[model samples]
Target chain A: MSLLVVGSVAFDDLETPFGRRERALGGSATYFSLSASRFHPVRIVAVVGEDFGPDQMRVFEGRPIDLAGLSKVKGLSFHWKGAYGYDLNEAKTLATDLNVFADFKPDLPANYRECDYLFLGNIDPVLQLDVVRQMARRPKWIALDTMNYWIRGSRPALDAVLKEVDILLVNDAEVRELTQEYSLIKAYKKVRALGPSTLVVKRGEYGVALFTPDGIFAAPAYPLENVFDPTGAGDTFAGGFLGYLAWIERTDVTALKHATLVGSVMASFTVEQFSTERLEQISQDEVRNRLALFSDMIRVEDL
Target chain B: MSLLVVGSVAFDDLETPFGRRERALGGSATYFSLSASRFHPVRIVAVVGEDFGPDQMRVFEGRPIDLAGLSKVKGLSFHWKGAYGYDLNEAKTLATDLNVFADFKPDLPANYRECDYLFLGNIDPVLQLDVVRQMARRPKWIALDTMNYWIRGSRPALDAVLKEVDILLVNDAEVRELTQEYSLIKAYKKVRALGPSTLVVKRGEYGVALFTPDGIFAAPAYPLENVFDPTGAGDTFAGGFLGYLAWIERTDVTALKHATLVGSVMASFTVEQFSTERLEQISQDEVRNRLALFSDMIRVEDL
Candidate 1:
């Protein structure tokens, strides 16, 4: 069975110390589908404007991604312009024209509703909840990603969605903000109580921390000499993780660690270029080799 | 075999989100010795003052640590007061009093001269160079740790010593500062070029990363529910690492990975309480079990 991803598909104008780009193909589902498509078949439900031309949307054409639920509206596509300086962790928002995405009411198609996997990318909790309600058959596994925006603006809605999902993708600071706890372990416990049994806190460049009732696991990011643009790196990470889990058809302890590393590897590739350039072009052999390198890098034999 | 640790032994007043403590047994050599002494015998070469009374100095007792080279002067011991806000990565120094430590010329005891492993903690680079010069027999493995202060203030001296060291233990920021490079991998390469064949960049709370001429390895910190104080976590890490190498009598690729995890485990315990209270009392079984847990956390089978 395939994975169903619901989030924004938009254009991003980005600037970093390395260079700049204007109106590149960007957004949560756009990135997630591309990265996840590398491993498992992916379907996206997102809204785009008429301005988002056929050529701009061709990044998903040759991949195992179904755009059956992608909506092309009359207005401009959701557009965001941002910049990064020394610290790639924080994005400086130059402007955001959420013309089409502002009215994003996710409407899942028939095939989409029957999928076994679902990813509610960073979006309005109300919309995320609506998609959950539209599913014809409950997915085997569902992971949700939310930003600080919905947590502060729509707590009740966020809380309602949290109880249904199997995992919540959060950043270190956002986790603290969600639970009002400074300590991450405390934050992890509090966050799990809100919804998902599996909580993965993305720590930007440092790495990601995984928490389950069984125990906790921390995974480091693939160390890079340069990070061109950190934009969409998180979504790409989710894509890798969910994609791997979908491919393996298991979410056990070993699979969780494997997924976490794949997520980090995908994210490392995502930041090496603007938009999904690296993610789209990454070969299976390159991924296997890189994963092997990572395996060697962190290998430990018990004493 | 034992590790020779050279640095200050001081009193620390610390404030963190967990709580506060005053003038507790602190300093680089003190923490390193305490942590390393658990695995292999550790000989400390540094100076304290008469004010570091019997009760205050009793933390080192009942431990496999040699104090033959630890000097006691007539004046007060070196004192440092620091605070950690929401961001535990940075230790905001509120006070620093270098009393007897100011005149410390590491007069290594004759027996200390034949050591195989040497760890030079964050101190004046010039003093570090002097210790290297005074060694009766060059150590088999010499790792160096220097602060941003010496990097900025004593660049030439730091450079001179860097050329002689086997490895350099740098925190992420100090490496960035030393090379004027924001990218960690690039910074690691630049630091390696300056000296030391091996480089380990310590990312607080995140993890410790190791790089040799061979390849790179990344190890995550042991997840802690609470990081009571991060004062000497890095030193403890070095102690565990170097001490383990001393015990195993190896620094091969597998050995380096093993040492990295041991370092992470030791640092984890150090952060659980103020000063070296946790490190001073941890059992071998506890270390073995914790290391095993970390081994499981980062485990990945070859793809």
Candidate 2:
């Protein structure tokens, strides 16, 4: 199954307890594509700037990723500056330079119009809806990710796109904020009322919780001794989740549960270093071994 | 196997988002005994006051619990006034009047001294150590629970008791505070050096994580729509954990993992209502059913 993601492609300045990186390859689509590519082909529909060079292109070299929809504009790329303390769960954004991204318009290539799986990354809700409308036909499954910014500032636009989404992914706080409900089950109910039948609530270090009509499944994050950076953990998690579903080509409870675990396993690797450094270097065998380890960590059996 | 616990027994005035309870029976030992007695015979060694009446005693009636060591002092019983907001994770303490508890001393009964399993609930570290010393012989297993006050105020005493404890259970925050480490894995390592071979980090709402010589096992809390009060959840979790171990009489990783789920099941019921109301009325069948449900929530298997 073909997967398409529409979001930001940016350069980031990150400072963490472990180290620092300037102008590192980042963005929602970047992390999502790299993570999803490990499972299936990922087609990126995001705009980059002239500053995105061969070195950055090499990061995706030899990978099954299509960049036909990656538009290169004249202005600088989307750039962000963030820092993290000992508590790696939250990041403090110091600066966000949307330069070319501020006036961005996602125009998917003809080849990407019929992707079986679609992931609308965190962008303006209006833009997200526009991408869905431009799809040659509705994808088999459409998962959308939004943030507090759109949830508060563009409720109608967000709701408009949410109606077209089959799956929704948001962090724990965003879900509560979006629904104005502290209880996750209640928030999930409200989300289901809006549109998406499946909601994956991402709890950075705590793990991820999946809520569907069948029931709820909660997966714990892999216990790590050190978390170098947490910049794109959420997007990487979304990629892994949707990517696994695309590869397996199923949406049943069992498949969703496995996807939830696979997402945790992918995000666990993302936080091990700045940007997609760890994601770019991890082997499939390592991912499977960690998934097995996580299974043991959460498994319960009778004597 | 007989289990013995030495901690406070108090009367609580509570206010939560759902409702309120005045002069409700509440305390570490009270919740612990009520939860543990459901699985095995529990012996409580703690001090009360003249105000303690037959109605208060009825909370423990017909349960497999020994109250012979419940001392009635001259002063009033320990009283606590607390409130909770929509975020049921933390409580706001308005007042705490430790009248009789201030001058309390744990005096174990003859029969209680040789209990095969012993639990030292949250109390003065000195008193916990004294109870450990008074045992006729070392119990088959010894578990201890402590809090921030003792961790910050009585380091030497707490350290002395930690040397003799086979298992230690404390909330996530307390574990980090005790070792001054922000990372849970690092904190668990520091705790291992302190002498307790097994450390159970009780994360309310999020779930429980057990760290032992073998490895780690994490369990997710049962997702609930209504959480009335969360006052004694940690103590109740401890009671369920030690009680299950006492019932099975095993400390293997599998047993410990099952025990972790049982503890979560017990704690889930404790928060359904204020004080011991829910714990008192729950049937063993309900507990087992919830345990099975929890296993289904966390269990991961291949498709």
Give the per-residue lDDT digits (tens) of candidate 1, residues A1-303. 779999999899999988999989899999899889889999999999999897877788988889889989889999999999878889999999999888889888887878788999998999999999999878888899998888899999999999989988989878888999877778878877887888899998888988887778887788887789999999999999999999999978778888998988988999999887787898999888888877776666665
Which regions of candidate 1 are displaced past 4 Å? none
Task: Score candidate 1 by lDDT.
Answer: 0.88
> Global lDDT of each model?
0.88, 0.90
Q: Candidate 2 residues B234-269, lDDT tens each?
A: 999989988999998887899998888888899999
**TM-score of each predicted structure versus truth:** 0.98, 0.98
Where model 2 places Cα greater than 4 Å from the true spot, the runs are: none
State interface RMSD in Å for all models.
1.9, 1.7
